[model samples]
Target chain A: MVADTASYHRIVLDSRPAGRPTADNFRLEEVAVPTLEDGEVLVRNHYLSIDPYMLGRMSTGVSYAPSQPLGEVMIGEAVGEIVQSRNKEFPVGDHVVGQLGWQEMALSDGQALRRVDIGAAPMSAHLGVLGMTGVTAWYGMTQICSPVAGSTVVVSAAAGAVGGVAVQLAKAKGCRVVGIAGGSRKCKYVMESLGADACVDYKKHADSAALGRAVGSHAPDGVDAYFDNVNGWMLDGVLPLMNRFGRIALCGMISRYGDTPMQLSAHSYLLISRLRAEGFIVWDHLDLWPQALQELTDLLQSGSLRSGESIAEGIEAAPAACIGLLSGENLGKQLVKLN
Target chain B: MVADTASYHRIVLDSRPAGRPTADNFRLEEVAVPTLEDGEVLVRNHYLSIDPYMLGRMSTGVSYAPSQPLGEVMIGEAVGEIVQSRNKEFPVGDHVVGQLGWQEMALSDGQALRRVDIGAAPMSAHLGVLGMTGVTAWYGMTQICSPVAGSTVVVSAAAGAVGGVAVQLAKAKGCRVVGIAGGSRKCKYVMESLGADACVDYKKHADSAALGRAVGSHAPDGVDAYFDNVNGWMLDGVLPLMNRFGRIALCGMISRYGDTPMQLSAHSYLLISRLRAEGFIVWDHLDLWPQALQELTDLLQSGSLRSGESIAEGIEAAPAACIGLLSGENLGKQLVKLN
Candidate 1:
């Protein structure tokens, strides 16, 4: 009798982790598919996006978005096909992307969800290069840093979703690109695939000074623009090596997410270098998305810019995929494929 | 005898201090006035500007400019009459301001000196309000922060030379100005004299959170613009209360000057708020000085703006004045007046 019941699988927050996340922090279970209310659309998620920013939502703190409550459906974005719709704007069989959580079936009020053209790019691309990740890289690079040709540009976590796109965008602008990534494998991919001029293996370097020297060796003049994702030792390294009037776009600070607040002694250096450091969220600049998405979509289609995805199958694998992504095991954009 | 000889008094950096400086760090001695070379001018300084930046010159470190070598004449700016001139650019009896160092008489090559009109303001005003100090505050306010009318503006070390002028400028722009000063006396002067809307006594608040809460109470809507002079606890306090898209002009880090560098934990808050924090030195923006100084002069002459000075007589008193200035004992612009 139970096997005949209509149900779907979903992952929810089991408990907040002490520091780095583990599989025990998430719980997967089967629940009956809820009836779609008026003006709601039911979607069967095909792909789920697992990003570094989600780590911030898992913990209790003052973040850009509110923290995810305990024992709730894990907050995330997904690409899916609408199975049923009561809203005129979204009909059945329409492919879409929205913040639908880590669930196989999701009910949306049609406000947050947006129709995606499957012909534009792969369905998974909507959650990666052609979506928020690509838009973040574009806005942070073009709007904030605005690197000029011939200038040296540095990006931390350069093999990750946003950083991967940032390094490519900087390269397209003819700026000499340098990427900092953990381990030699990611560093190599950042250099050879991402077209960065140099790669600094942060894991090999014990301290920021060592990283700074390595960065200096590649960028003899100094980094003219910086896309900062890892804000701890990487930031300290870049501060000393930044050129006069350098611009820094703070995209993410994954390194400091689990650690105690650390003091930055680079204030004097910031003054001496006359640097501009700014922090931004993509949601704040959504107006620029349509134009940015068009460009990113073109690049992805034309093979001018490439997007790599490390995908895990099934909803149960999302937790491990996210953990692996944070630990630098994932090559590029981390995603979970669910049908 | 040495006293009867035709000599001028000058202070030199005898040794670099580990932390807080002592009188022994400076040696004030009588030296024969050097003959002016081609294109050189000899000036008898009437007022020598003593500022917080001099501490950076006294220490061996990386700064905007090269560090001042030990046992050398302490470098600084002064306003005095060009008593003798060999260069056509700087005529005799012309009042001028230049990097003439801490001395009664100085020789300049005319390249670094600029003529100052005494009728524009007082002679000492050339070394204070109408000089680099005023120019700094103006550029930091107008260029970096650019607070709009009716917005809340906060300045740390609010009664000091740069911050005092910044508060007044923000007030002139019709902004709600809040000042953070060391003591009740300076706080009172900042509020009543400088036309600031509020003054917080940072000395009374033991920690950053308390100061932040106090600032929050005054600026319930939250701080819109911050001109940061002291960069330790005060910066910690202001970072939390800053509103979305807040702008911070980093003028000086006086709090971190003598202490070991500490980590800043608010990078997360910065990302959430999407703030722009920039550090600059006025020397880099001399192109804007003429317009800024003219505006500052007009304000001072019209009594729309006020300037305060803490005069320490004689070149021998310069070291103690600097020490007192660093310790937050001096009320306003710390100047060594030589008659």
Candidate 2:
């Protein structure tokens, strides 16, 4: 059932950006498909995930993982179907999700690849809520934030992929969830769709002090936990509003993924309120992925957890999609649909 | 056994400092000592502990505890001899330690008071190594830092009261300890007296970047745990040097206690390294004090734990001593010997 295509298009890292990334940073190249060896399979990519963390991998700086090598396939997660398989475990026509990069096709040895059930959810959902982003939300929220019933939880980037799921999970735990997003439109989605008790539009505030006042008005009782996605000024704004013994789950610092020098002035609140601020990457907690995915799938099927997507058509749109994602231009999960 | 003196001198808060505290902010007034009631005792304070945490209480801003009430006795911990008592628990001439404030004499109802064994250690030791400062160090090191054998542990303000004990405790655990202090003298004390593997003098470095380089040269393998006492530039300097899954026990932020807007630009290192930074107040962990004190007392008596004190002449010198402590002028525990 394999298609007779000789070559596939893939995006490679052309140059590292000095500040914010641009289209010039990526170069799309057409390469011949390799013959599958024994125990290997060829996958036809369906959806490629465009995440903020990819920016960290692109920069030649210290990140949780090593920087993505220049002149190589841009690193990312993807959901695709096995069109040609030499491995019995991954049979032809089976859908799988793994680190498949920004390509139309990927050859894998079945290692680190999870067989996704397309009957339960859409193929693209495997690149989003039912995949790594969802697991990220679960780990940071359940393990780090750990909000209890009636406790107030504040989520930065609350309309983005991980933050959106985190907001829902905290709300499901019977918490008073307050969301901070860039625009009023996303803030509305955070409140209405994600079931957050209140949402603060950070764009409306001039500085962290002003944003803090807006957050304080909504969370009259101080915040018990903070699920931080965009760290910088958002972290500064929420820290002072945290109650004594509050927790801060540092999931991502999307605000500082570029070369921007983000200043954190309200860190003193960490001692003043006796707070616990812990940073974590989802990849480190791989042992919990199975349990996290099970609960997330149940929530999704039960109509409790909801997610939105902003799809950029074709592999060529991957670079601009990522740039848009960093600027908070996307509503939720930003994905590139491959043809 | 009570002395015939009818009146005693005490220092009270005259005004809250806009920035760093001054002598004018305190008022020395003579007041008549109160007669003992049914469950009361009169204590003549011998040594008053001048801690950095008192600055937080003196500020009008939010702190771990309530701000010190103005025009009242300055909040502090004191070691003294009970001159007279109506309670059976605290007899006359028994040496004790409690929150006796900045005064030559204190009247207590036997609440929150602990009797000290002067035979084990000196009377002033009750105000330093064997008292709240020691307990604070114990809780932060054991509960938060929790460094294992062969780990590289870094302690900021390593020559100070709590940091000195923390340095020794980590050393006892068979870990390589690196200390950060103000000058060459304190750095020498950290290495020779506290038994640290290496000590970095932060005063020699112009900026955090320079200090980080000095620390990196000493701890080439990267820091596993950091017991932070001074949390402004010192914390920024050390954060980038932390290994994966490192723990930072935020014991104090003496640098930011005054009117200083500390800008932490290296906070992204928290997410990059997946670090856990937790702030704690020793008062919350009172349940663990008995266990901590038992271990500390054993270590002290066994000569495993060592501490130094810079004692001022009398209660009149308490204000200057505190000011000096904040500036990193005090070599170790700053205390005022009250007469």
Candidate 3:
């Protein structure tokens, strides 16, 4: 008799809806795990990433990163251990990173795969500070903004995955960093826990113009570099207040990610005025990766950098995890695990 | 009886108002010509620049060059003879360049004044090609964009003041210059007369998206550097077709200069998608001006660089001339002559 073997759960994109995403759009399905190919590895996902940028991928629209097609496996990066390996470069029992989909068992090519080092850092951190989040912060602050010592650097979404790392890195470089997060607790975490010079609770600010004024108030020296993750209104304040030749490293626009098509047309002042802003894809700077990784790894090794992971229990909660990610409920890095 | 006190005719901004400038917005007034001071020279107005940039001066907004306040003499550059001089550096009858008012005679400190020998080139040529217009084109194209030989360089407002010089300059540098102009006549002038590599008639080309496709057809290599003068919707089309690492020099945005307030929100797809696009005021590179001026002057002397101008007869025609300049009706540098 044939073996009765199947992974009994899958999160399917149920429908393409308007504006913000809802729990109803994602449907859970029972499915059979596929066999691995000759040159493939089978991975049981240990963690799934929940990023604001994922909200961009969920919608079918034009963006720097192409969105996931409706009814397709929602695209994201994940960390897991290799259950079976047929590729010469990879072996069984290896802790690996791959886009293994929102499922229990999946096949992957050796392409874009890297072994996670539990000795270098914690296992869960591969989804947060040591992974894409850490790299993004490293690249945006150092490469895009390139703040000098004593320059006042401001980062939005301060307590989130990328913001937390950027704040600490900027602090290490002698820059005075200000973070804008959602709550007083997050603000305290940014200032005391992450070494930011100050943090603003944007939710209490009432408007972005007011938030910008508050940021300006904190840095009487004028803002030298603005690391923008949240777009829409708060950016309006910072743009006018940016010092001459000030640089804005635009990593992502989380606020506008889930809005309808019409929201795209309301902000031209970003380009028209005297400000200079640049957006980049991470892979574009592959040559800098080794150096960046070395520097960040050194910082991690010395305990100068700290990280947090909002770990969800299993593969079944991935949909709710995504919803929580978009709503800003998840603190630091949001990750999902399945055994 | 009043010792034949010299009075000169001038245009003054009567009051700041909303929308496109009208004849009534400026008033013709007669003012007493001031005597030269210790470091000043008295210049007789031979020619006055009537540029589209002046349209912005009609408003009270901030700019690289401060705006002229209401009841103040409209500020501009003039190519005039040093009819009177108290400054030992500038002797009378010397052909001088100065920021004299829109008047027959005026007093000015020797700041921004240059005594040019018109035996090599026309006095008005200095005002257009060898002066600010020429310097703007040279700096914006060579220094900012850095178009290499064999790259595709696209220029908008092709047959106008800056466009005319940019075409010749790009061609001289071995770049294939494609121009976007308004009509068949301008297209013919841009290609046949000024020697543009190709010309695109934006008005005849339906939507800007289709226009971009057509322009790309001629420039299969895609755009290398975009010397932008006209912004708004035309800018929308050009943004998508630029090659990776393409440079855009924002010297002027004529489309947005009119009195009408624009709800100018553009999509993320417009500009941020490009790998590199930067904007700067030309004066930021003033330290290199002496070298840039010497190089351009050498080109002008050798007939390698050229210029074109559209001159209006009298001071009364200045308002209509400015309107025509805004509408892209005049090709080359639009100027008003007062003998």
Candidate that beats the other on DockQ, 1 or 3, i.e. the better one = 1
Give one digit per residue, the lDDT tens place, for model 3 in B112-206: 78777788688888788877788788887887678989999889998998888888789889999999999998999899877898999999877
Clashes of each: 7, 0, 2
Candidate 2 vs 3: which has more DockQ? 2
**Higher-ranked by TM-score: 1 or 3:** 1
Model 3, A42-150: lDDT tens per residue?
A: 7777777877777766776766667677776767788877877899788988888767677666678888887888788877787778887888899989987899999
For model 3, the chain A TM-score is: 0.92
lDDT, candidate 1, at B273: 88
Q: Tell me the lDDT of model 1 at A89.
A: 95
TM-score of 1: 0.95
**Quick one: best lDDT, which candidate?**
2
Estimate every model's Cα lDDT from 0 to 1: 0.88, 0.90, 0.77
Candidate 2, pairs of clashing residues: none
User: Whose lDDT is higher: candidate 2's or candidate 3's?
Assistant: 2
Chain A agreement with the truth for model 1, given as TM-score:
0.97
What does candidate 2's lDDT look like per residue over B1-339, in tens digits?
123489888899999987878899998888998988999999999999999888889997767788999999999999999998999999998999999999989999999899999998999888888899899988999999999999999999999989998999999999999999988999999999889999998889999899999998999799999999988888999999999999999999877878676888898888889999999999998899889888989999999987689889777788888878877888778899875
What lDDT score is found at residue B285 in candidate 3? 69
- After superposing candidate 1, which stretches have Cα over 4 Å from the reference? A1-6, B1-6
